[model samples]
Target: MSTRLRIALDAMGGDHAPDMVVDGADIARERCPNVDFLFVGDEQRINALLDARPALKAISQVRHTADVVAMDAKPSVALRSGRGSSMRLAIDAVASGEAASVVSAGNTGALMAMAKFVLKTLPGIDRPAIASMLPTMRGDCVMLDLGANLECDADNLVQFAVLGTVFAQTVLGLLEPTIGLLNVGSEEQKGHEAIRTAASALRATPLARNFHGFVEGTDIAAGTVDVVVTDGFTGNVALKTAEGTGKLFGEFLRRTFQSSLLAKLGYLLARTAFNKLRQRMDPRRYNGAMFLGLQGVCVKSHGGTDGLGFANAICVAVDLVQHGFNEKIRKELALLQESLQAASAAASGSDPQAVAQ
Candidate 1:
């Protein structure tokens, strides 16, 4: 809290536009006293909302941008024509050092495209993967490549493990978080070649001690590992499935509680427990999805989320900034790169030093 962090908010990016964005910032202001906000959108609307919250307004500034990225905008088209859009300007703030991070509840693909183009990937990182936390029986689990790359090779998967590991350490406060590669089965011989190769590489490196190898889909909810790594296509599908399942479960519970007079009586008796369960499974608590591997922190909030959800996204950006998440990732990756070079040398029957060069 000693050093004030400036976070850029894409005021026109979300479904609710400046209203949700400003309300979210107000909530964030109460939680993070040392943080300042840069609201990028139409100055008039943003200021009008801020006027109602004098305390938040005191620590906020607005940058007028007439252009807004449509919720359904194509990533390709947005990248080509959204130069002065609110989302793009917010990202530019981070790249230009005007802000410590950028948060948006915008089109996921467009945000990813603009962020990658503006912030670029970290050194030794080929692509930035989408990472987010999932509520699990053992607390929370970190999963990556939620929807970044549709198809990834072995190397991409390897990098995702590294990214997920560092993220767990930084955010989850785990000294040695176990990692697993998502697959059809937990057997070593299962899954496609890319996943198997990635698993082998992870096991051969220093990360082997913390690597739990291949895990099935059920392992994700079971918290079989602290980090789950997979290609974007698979990871995205898993994420959506989990979301749908949560919704379906809630609906089933509602119907069961309303089935009959006996059921209604039972619901009253279990209301307290159900309340606790609802709090534990609140989607707002896990609204932020980080685009890891970018040079600057870029958090993507769910586009349709409410103010509370967006506020949680702001908190995520603050946590990453305070923890120096990118620095930790770079340090871990440096060590991993060295280990990989040594393994390559051993495979080729060459000197490790020469292979590194």
Candidate 2:
């Protein structure tokens, strides 16, 4: 919070890169004069985009580099040969201390691989998880390992819940964030061994007092849980399902309204209300993906993301920096781990499953 936050942006890494990344940068600079931005990508194309648009001409220039790692490129291979690739450079910039944060929409695997190499995990963390915000009925919950680590054990899940609670507090500003082990049912014995063991450990920890019991998929948006911890396989499935469902629902609504004049009139009257709802629920609004459990905050947007989306991701990274997200995660997890150990010692003679249920 003491220093100005500068974000290194991978301009060409997303689905809507360059334009989206550029526009988002412009928005951030205009909104917060204190926040500076640096874009990493093709010099000619980036300058051309800036040149063509008077709105962005006044902002900072792109840090020119020709290396580009295709979305499908292997993470290790990309790490070595990605060279000047915008994503690689952006992360490297952060590692070198030239940048406070990095934002990209490029390859998730590559991003995670590169980030782990550069930032490394905090002392207690085994791997950094990709945490994202999801709409919940009560409000929103931060879900982790959305796609970073595919096979997570009980310890990994426990770590996620701990770190996720820290994230919810720092970024989401939620005090005493409720942590939950994502499962198929609410029963204590619902999930596999990982869930069962993690639940027992979390509940036994002092911080476990802050953690709630198991939650199901329906609770994701109902806001029944503040933080949802699961393996990347499940988290990824949930994320994609939410996105697909939203898109399909939106398309359905548009199509239905277009079929008749009456529907059109209704849409017109509800346009503002609809837009408000859309903005609230839009993935674009919550576009940034956080690399949790790292020394610094690194965000990955959708590769095809536009300037606005990538820029928003940058803004998210800056916000994380300002909130001391990484430090908070370390502190909170230490507390949780200590609590777990003490509780274990005290209950060495007690029945765990009995206590858990």
Candidate 3:
């Protein structure tokens, strides 16, 4: 077993493959000196790019494989035929204990399907969630089930809350992260039975102090809670809406700046402020989406993102490994199970099956 912290990279998974992947590895190497990389893809192509960056070459190894997963491949097709592809092999490294985690900029569905099939879920988690950090008025907030499960039950929602809370504490470094269930409104009767049941269950748990009733769509940007939990369908729609809104706002600003000579002059004077805002809103800054509740760390980067964005994704994988994220999640989950079991026993006369149900 290797003593060094090794990350498996799907070198041919992105839009601007091999080159973008190699360049991103170089940048990540600079930021995380203690980390090493296992580049899994076409050896010749990867080496051709790495040859120029001897510094990156020293800390990385190229595992030769000619197969590559197509960006448009369906999850079922990819799983059935892409066994030797870069994405699948990279994930295999984590399962075989050759790497601490896997990072890929590939088809989201394929990646998730392969990861779940290979790595499986953690002890107390039934389904894994896709989670990412979102910029907010207060600071960065964690949101989960970005597009993992189309439909989720009350128990699934509760599990997502636990996952998001652990992520905030591990990566975001929040002491007691506040959690809220995304809903149509803040009122107790706003959503369906599942959301209400999940909310009620959370309120009864030991983590009740951190639960903040319910939150609406506006609350996501307002940073009403440190962690937001919801089913993947709703979460995915919300994420796309936010992205669209940001792009629309940027276009509006651009048009305003070019409207008149006076506007141009104002832009010149306020260039510094605009640049700061751009940096903060840069999508690359938040490229990594984690597959929470998995037994191993698996981060998915945007396929169209550039080297800088890919580097941020690698950083996310490294941070999770260094922080022992999975272990902490397991510990927190055990506590939640015990709390739930005790409550169920007290209410239903020692029926363990009641808690499971």
Candidate 4:
């Protein structure tokens, strides 16, 4: 059997459709020569795009499908009527073991719904969390529940922490990654009961050696922890706010530089430094958001990203597959379960027994 990784692509799902998807595949192919692709979309459109990239054509196969899920379609509607859609077909490829992973720049809700229905959650996981790497002061940090579960309980938060920890170790190559719960303050008494309970559980587990307690919003950029754990609601809001702040900062610098002749001349002198800053802040470098805790690998690319951004998403999938991400998660989760059960048993034993009447 061939050891090469095969990835399924939803070629008709993005704003730019087959063109961007095909071009991205070409870029990713160049980077990962051993990887093959199965493109699911309108065969004619995909072939037309591939005509210009003979190299990509040699490593890719097209699975024809004319149906596409609309960008604004409700998840329920897509689930009910999108059986033949490109996104669903691409996910099906993974479920059927035809591909190692699936990538799509499609409707977020529809993609998640379809993927969950098709691939199902990993054993011992109640829900899959959305995880992505963020550029931090120290380096990249993994954050989870990025708009996946809006209302998570203490167990869910703990589960997300385990998922994020495994991601950091597998993808980031960290030996012992530190984790933190995102809260308003770092004190033990702060935040909701769910977060506090999750914190206590983490501290009592094997993960406590690397757990950094609670961290605030500033800690995200400061890289206070290797992983940041939170509910989907807070994580989504934090991600958007950080994105907007970065854009605003860029705009402010642009206006400042163009304010006068002297400022423009100063900018020219610092052009190299500014270029490095631009590269560091480029969103394309971090375009892929992984659906962690799934039985199979699924990466969601930004719907409006360009070929380069989509290529990064493809790279994320390939890395997850090669690194044995899901297997690692399962092993870690099993250990976590054992530790929690043992702790529960100890607590029960310590409680006084009721007298027989």
Candidate 5:
């Protein structure tokens, strides 16, 4: 029998957990036929969803935990103190080699804490940055530190650029991903000290300099670069703002469509065009976020995400595994670490769980 892409999903971790998670599982099954899902959560609740559906009824389940960590709860507390929580189980499953990937639309912090504690980061990767795809003019470009690793230094940002570049090449299928330091200006010395420092380091480094430079906020959705690297503080804000703007603009379009009979007629005439725009801006399409710099694949979904978001996250997981993300990233990271060491004539390490100093 062919081996399935085994995945353990946190059914009770997200805002729409269990119900949305279950529906997402169904969506994945219908779409990614090669994947084998194992929902980890309350047995009765999972069974209730499974029993409600015929195809899903045949799917498997692993009743790992009985509790859940709320969205706002601190991840350290949840991962450390909340014993046997659903998110913990899912991360533990991947760490224990029980599954190939772990999908959590739950607490971002909680999920990251558990994954870092469990699967662990790849060697030489100081921290695992979460990179989510953005709806850019050219297509989807990656924006790093979406919510993971809130406090990052210049070195960490450089590492993210290295990681993001490989992610762009392998996952996004970019031939030579243009690396950009998310900055206030395109000038080399434009951002914070950390950013300016990172830009210099990035330029000096051979691996990252491949189609590399600096990018400003205006260049984000405009597609000036393939990868946008920045500290978590900046990157997360940029991502959220873009998300909010997209939603608000879409709402405006909908309101305008319903404002008047003339507008409604315009909508009818441009119905196909509007549908295309909707597809491009749909939050569901870019719902997946890869926890970059990890040894194995850990794709994070939005906690408030629903069935469609879940499906998109699953597709992200499948694509990464299918394209061998871990293996590819390993080489790139090693190259970066080695080059940094050689160039500086000193050991510069990116150790996971390393002190953030």
Candidate 6:
């Protein structure tokens, strides 16, 4: 009968299925003892796993669901016919106020579509964005629109900047985080019209104080800015390229260490350093990608991740909900709107069309 922070999980959505979901809940339970869970998936399989973890089972409830969204299923197909799916049911729990948020290691495209459809976008937010933090030498940096809207106008980019700012503040604990537009070059005259327009628009707002202008791909790793804003097509490519680079370097190190006996000896001498490097580069630490701008909190876990990764995703959801992320975004955006309106009134005698300039 205890009122706890509840999270809904799509128990059958991951590559590992009910086992991974149940195990993750167990791990997440240790980190977040106050949280309860609503697991939406095959009741029989889920219960069997839960029965083994009495502690997790004590705080969990299972809602039977047989339908599942395929990993490779088209977003359009899933959206039209995935109503009874575990992914959909879990999301529905959040929309109905039965859960504070939903976490799933499911199909990302389907999750985004269903979440936007069910929870709707926040007022003034035309589209939701996929945002997550990445490790940088200076610390972690937040980036957004990572595969959500491939094509974005100046307004959409501006909205992304707003969303990224709130995300960095609430999640990254950055005060007045610096914002930058991802571009081919750092020059003001570089990039396309949309980027140029967005940059000009940002300069007119209070965010201008922290806006750092255009940032190239290298700036992302250099931590030149706290938030990197780009269209989904560009952001997605950057994310994938970074991931691939990490893997390539890791492979190179492994091969180098095994190439000769002297190399093996050297690796042994530097084993502790290597272990630290491995931990620092671990992908599980950054497994959660939040679907920002939705009315409800929903986090997408990497489908290939193990229990630890999924648990991290659950923790991400917990952080967003606990910090009242959506409320903070609404408050920040309202203030931004008011500031724009005031500026418009002063500049053009309240000509609304002039504000877009």
What is the clash count for each candidate, in the order shown? 0, 18, 0, 0, 1, 0
Q: TM-score of predicted model 1?
A: 0.97
Q: Where does the lowest 10-residue lDDT sum fall in candidate 3? A: 347-356
For candidate 5, write residues 1-357 as lDDT tens digits: 777888889889778788998889889888888887888899888888888887876766657568888889987798778668888888777877888888888888888887888788888788999998897889889989776777788889888888898889887899888888887788775767887888778765765447457788989999988888887888889998988887788889899999999999999999998789888778888898889888778888887888999999988898888888889888887777766766565335553334444
Q: lDDT of all predictions, in order shown? A: 0.94, 0.83, 0.94, 0.93, 0.83, 0.94
Higher-TM-score candidate among 1 and 4? Answer: 1
- For model 1, the stretches where C-alpha displacement exceeds 4 angstroms are 353-357
Model 4 misplaced stretches (Cα beyond 4 Å): 350-357
Q: Name the regions of candidate 3 deviating beyond 4 angstroms.
A: 1-3, 350-357
Could you tell me which residue pairs clash in candidate 1?
A: none
- What tens-digit string does per-residue lDDT give for candidate 1 at 13-35? 88887898999998998998899
lDDT, candidate 6, 1-357, per-residue tens? 755899999998889987888999999999997899999999999999998999999999999989999999999999999999999999999999999999999999999999999999999899999998999989999999899999999989999999999999999998899999999998889999999999998987879999999999999999999999999999999998999999999999999999999999999999999899899889999899999999999999999999999999999999999999999999878877877777667776866666578
- How high is each candidate's TM-score? 0.97, 0.91, 0.97, 0.97, 0.93, 0.96
Candidate 4 yields a Cα-based lDDT of: 0.93
Top-TM-score structure, candidate number:
1
Single out the weakest 10-residue window by summed lDDT for candidate 5.
346-355
Deviating ranges (above 4 Å) for candidate 6: 1-3, 350-357
lDDT value for candidate 5?
A: 0.83
Query: Residue 243 error for model 2, in Å?
Result: 1.4
* Stretch of 10 with least lDDT, candidate 2: 52-61
> Model 5 off-target regions past 4 Å?
346-357
| Residue 107, model 1, lDDT | 95
